[model samples]
Target chain A: MTDTPSQLPAHDEASIRVDLQLVADQIKADSRVLDVGCGDGMLLAHLRDTKHVDGRGLELSMARVSSAVREGLAVIQGDLEADLKHYPADAFDYVILSQTLQATHNPKEVLEGLLRLGTHAVVSFPNFGHWKVRLALLLTGRMPSTPTLPESWYDTENIHLCTIKDFLSLVDELGVTIEAGFALDGNGQKRSYKATGWLANLFSEQALFVLRH
Target chain B: MSVLDTSSDNALAPRLTLEGPLVLQSGVSLSPVTIAYQTYGTLNAEKSNAILVCHALTGDQYVAGAHPVSGRDGWWHHVVGPGKVIDTDRYFVIGTNVLGGCMGSTGPKEINPETERPYGLLFPVITIRDMVQAQARLLDQLGIEKLFCVTGGSMGALQTLEWAHRFPERVTAAVPIAGSYRHSAQNIAFDEVGRQAIMADPEWRQGNYLEEGTVPTRGLAVARMAAHITYLSEPALQRKFGRRLQDRENLTYGFDADFQVESYLRHQGSTFVDRFDANSYLYISRAMDYFDLAEENGGNLADAFKDTPVRFCLISISSDWLFPTSESRAIVHALNANAAKVSFVEVESDKGHDAFLLDEPEFHDTLKGFLDGAARTVGLDDGAQGESA
Candidate 1:
């Protein structure tokens, strides 16, 4: 299948975040995948290299989209909030949204749209209910700023930021089955966590969830 | 006005006049059809390295190197040179003047075989398919049975799609950049306005201006000016001219090219009339307006490529309102429905429809990547790559 040696690089999973690597692991080999808000297409490119998956990407930023296309990735410049409705149901085996869930205007609707587009969806987002953030908010009487959520309140893009517990509850409310979940520390190292627990919300800096409707 | 030299000896590009009667899509037959084309690089022994590059409206056969008539760089010199995206160093690139083109090709300006005069309005209206058929004949003459890739942008894109649809066996890969599967009503309206502008001019002489030894310079210029505006986006215009006065501090009250944009449009119009034929403009624009793949295929776009074996790389520009990304999406959807192998990229560019002609790094990279992949699939060995000499 690898006809072009120069393009098909050997597996080098060390470049991306461990959470994304975990998401990549969940994907079956040779399954079609769509990466929403796929900035620079690192995850998609990695999947292509390791799993031989046929991947497509939808990126919001033109510069990122251009960079992704320049890397020979099949990416289109589009808004995930608006463009997600265009994809047919089960058009892809997996629809992965990494670190961009909180930034959406309607994360719930976006989640629903993702599940509609793919058989399974893998989502990762910063957890705002970490103990450090809670402590900082409690002590300073201001919005907490941490390594994972480092943006100032005024200019931050994480509009609908949620805790890991909040996301799990939302999934339960939407009647979607949680296939798997993972937590990552501030340094992008994956940490084991129970699918439904308060410990994840308190300690995890970021959360990864795989959902199926 | 510079007169077109009909003599073949002084032509910059290679010219071929095919024998016999060539039937056009318009149900008209043209005998002794002449096609002017330019070839870059060398044809390999296996002939699997041939790439046919179709040019857009107003573009000529000078795909690389200086154009003899304009004495300027080729329109696509930036993308088609040595070690560039198309890489003239490795592939034998052939660019032809479309059937209804003015640059040394048989168009409205060409002399009629029977009358011994320019065809003018007597020339049958040609379609995009006619242009592709003409190119296919040219390819036959060149002994290239199958093209490694059939690529183009805008009107050229229409030709590229036509090649993939009409001759899937002959094309291994297709690249249609900043183009649509069919011309929209709005696009047809714009072309109509340009055609009306030419016909309204008294100097047009009912398409017989050639006989009168005069050219419809004003009308052609106005048409070119109107059409040129559609090629660029409002943001591009603002970024370039931005209400800036042309060679002056303040704006003139009267409409005498007061702004830089006005002056720019005027320059574009005037310079265009010098090189392009007014009659050829009418014919080509008509052809573009008549392009509708679905209309030809039982009103189902997917039917155009049903069970075809051709890899496609469809590209659209972000700000190209002329043929917006939505249109490209339609093509992608159709290709997907047909289960055809396709890849689509909507490159972010404020340059609008003309982005395909400009030096957009992402666009070039996408083309290079697609060609490289297609080349690998066709088993064409990668040769030593270097800069064009």
Candidate 2:
């Protein structure tokens, strides 16, 4: 549950991952990076610890900010909607908002803010149109609960949820230039997001998008 | 400049404040000031261990000596003892009354050179940065290359942070416990209320009340009593006194110290008036308000330390609601942003922000760890653990 004796462990299935190898490969070594919803500032810290990358982070939870800070990471206590403007234009080479877009008050506006502050924006979210959630909604009809969306409808902060296809349409509609796309299956391994186009939206558990403003 | 004896300077009866060209916050200058101070320990070979120990509100330079002016006990007896955290036996600890401070540093009590009278409200406002700049000059005149460490709490911490940011290279290390990069608006507002109270006093006489033996005791006392509330936590206050009545029975039904809390605050206020300069309080608090480290760095507190090589150990008490732990975390965040060598430990204490001065084992341990680590990093000549446990 925890990596170290003095560490706050991941409380749920969602937590920091060593799979930041993929995220680190996409950015320049010295480029400035900002990570939104940067839990324990894992990817940014990895980028900093190895790549000499200067990183900034925005996290809402006080405990997470303290944890990230204790690890010597520059994390700010901020909500995405309220604090995005504090960063100047093109302040970073990449603004990575992984696992946070779906929970924002205005995902499009946040994307725009991130784009304005960074040249490249990387967004990752659990694809709500995945087959299990669809089948759950179709069969049980209780707002769909799965391991991905563990919280009940009342406790969950995940609003404005979307599927891979819906997000792709969002990018196109918002004139966002998609640089790349990756999909993850139930086991949390990366694969092509284009396979069985119909099932990709209904079954691909997570989608990672790399886009330009 | 030959390495003339600093003792010669000290031997000249040590004119603490030569009071030159001290421009106030509102663009006026004060001169011919007096500074109350006390020196401890001795200057070593490189004159490098000149550690300045600043004090918070109500603290005088008698860091290790009886106050010559106020006749009060040394404020930090626990930390300034022979084998204490600040060990006067090895480290030359110099504590000076802040500019615009009571007890000696020129304030409402000092006479204005131009008018040949005390400059009460006419005393220009001062700032924490200004105080630091003045100290830097003093250190330069003393032929000290760099300070081993600048340590303080509360207002003292404010001054220490100013020293680090202002003379980053000169300060080898800094211990700004329970201080913020900028005063919170709430604190600023509190100080403003205190100033207004002093001004609103009937005997204030537009800052010339001293001529008539008119001191704004009531207003100043009220201000002190109010600010005293902020320096402690509800838990500390509650735990100490806890609605217990002072001296008499339950309901006196009059404006008196019916409760212990009331009596305690009154004592703090009255005693404050005895040794503190009311106008100096105004100036020092104003200085704290103007201390915004980020503003000087073009709104990025992190950029202020970008090129500096100073290591920092910021300690904050968790029970200190005044500065709080978040303020310390803010500074840590800034230091980390610049990738500077730094450590932060929010010592768990119920003694409020004043834990820096108390005999808290945890605080000492944290300081020992940081200091030992920093000394090893900088290759300072360490001889055992000097007696301080």
Candidate 3:
């Protein structure tokens, strides 16, 4: 997600990624949500339209933040690493970090901040351990790059990229309960396989987890 | 022309004097208070689309049309015109000269009825809340029970916040851009310097310059020069002027406007004195310094808006060190603590505090979105949407 140029989709929220839409589906109506690294606020807008959710966003890029705010979403220009600490504990019903976990400076601390700020935390990230990425790395003898993670290694912002297994281990260490999870393939289609275990990490192009303290 | 004219038949700026004396926050009663204002667009049958636009320190009632004194276009014409962000075609817009303003309002420059002379230093010290109180009187006279929105920037933003705090039920929504709940220490210091500059001039004559048959032009110019610097960012200055020479290539050792920056500052100062009153500057700046909403609410910012139903959209400029984004965030935190409906946007701009007045597309978009959203909740007709640039 970090490797892809940050292009805002059309105003139609249906054009948002399938994983983000799935995340939106889990949220109940009228709940307060905080979208970290919310980009142009597609999911927040969608949730506001569908769920009547009171949504707020924290986006690192001012350009994206400006666009989000233009679309009537409550967004502030902020860094996920530094700005998350300012939000009061349990200020939100749900905090969604969609496809932005890999680009954070400290994914664990960011996760801790998310859990602290919201009653439930939804996190999505590209799976670095996918079969295609592994095959490319083994055959090319270099860092793997796939369509989902398209940037050259030197220019990529995915400094802390991880797989489903890596994220599950961190969740276990933090002692949080995973309420729900979803796996998606390379075509941005949700896979019905159990979101955990070895096969999910190797084959799923991306993963989504709903965790609570 | 009498400054306290109670007649409402004036063609240019409409004037109205309140029915009774308005007791000031400083405990001084000001009788026959007058407010000069300009109105644009129709108020509609339901009268629910009224937006009260408060002007900043140096701003006046000219929100959209050309300014009478300066003959230049209104300061916020970019955002307040027919098809602009404020969109006069859709909403009823009213801009007023603040209580302590020099533009056809009862300020230090206005003549005192008791002494038949300019009030000057005799004008009672005012606060942001007091300014809003005067506006409320104006609204009462206009028969407007509730305002759809109240919006402003800089000192105007302070007034916007004051409107929401003092009369929560009267305001449907508010947009405070590049403002703070209280004046920061640095802000007070900068305003103090300007006041001192005005007082230091011999011609000022203890705020009696009007009686002395001479204006404190030099002092007012110097003060304007100092205050104008705070309105811009260092990056904007560097990009616009840098180390470039003015007019001549070689540097003149004799302090004759050697740099383009110096020339620019001088022009800003000189042009300012022609249209503003020095004593009015002192009164307005002092009012701003005394503004502290949190302190007024017993030092708990959240208490200022407890259980208030007003919606808010706060905006700050990224490069505005004078007001800063942190000030806006503090407001957001307080609103959150109170569980008030609020949204905040820190616009990325190199233009600094004055970005609120500049052509920042993002700022306009955010304002349009907030206003449009608020309009929906208030049951106002959307009408024809304005063309976005």
Which pairs clash inside model 2?
Answer: A130-A202, A131-A202, A131-A203
Please provide, for model 2 over B76-119, each residue's C-alpha lDDT reduced to its tens digit, 9 standing for 90 to 100. Answer: 87777566766666677888877776655666667777887777
Cα lDDT of model 3 by residue, A2-94, tens digit = 423233223254465566777887799999999887887878988988899988887777677767767777776667787676567888899
From the highest DockQ down, the ranking of the candidates is 3, 1, 2
Q: Is candidate 1 or candidate 2 better by lDDT?
A: 1
User: Candidate 2 clash total?
Assistant: 3
Highest TM-score: give the candidate number.
3
lDDT of 1 at B36: 92
Which portions of model 1 miss their true places by more than 4 Å? A1-14, A137-141, A173-177, A191-198, B7-13, B16-23, B29-32, B113-117, B165-173, B211-214, B232-270, B294-355, B359-381, B384-389
Residue B51 of model 1, lDDT score: 89
Name model 3 segments beyond 4 Å from true. Answer: A1-15, A135-141, A192-198, B1-12, B238-263, B297-308, B336-343, B384-389
**Per-residue lDDT of model 3, residues B1-389, tens digit only:** 11222222353468888889999999999987999999988887777878999889999889888877678999899899888899888888999988878877788877899999889899999888889999999999999999999999999999999999999999999899999999999999999999999999898999998877778888888999999999999999999999999999898789799999999999998888888888989999999999999999999888898877898889999899889999998898788665566767888899999999988988898899878777765666475333111
Best by lDDT: 3
Q: What is the lDDT of residue B233 in candidate 1?
A: 99
Q: Tell me the interface RMSD of model 1, in angstroms.
A: 3.2
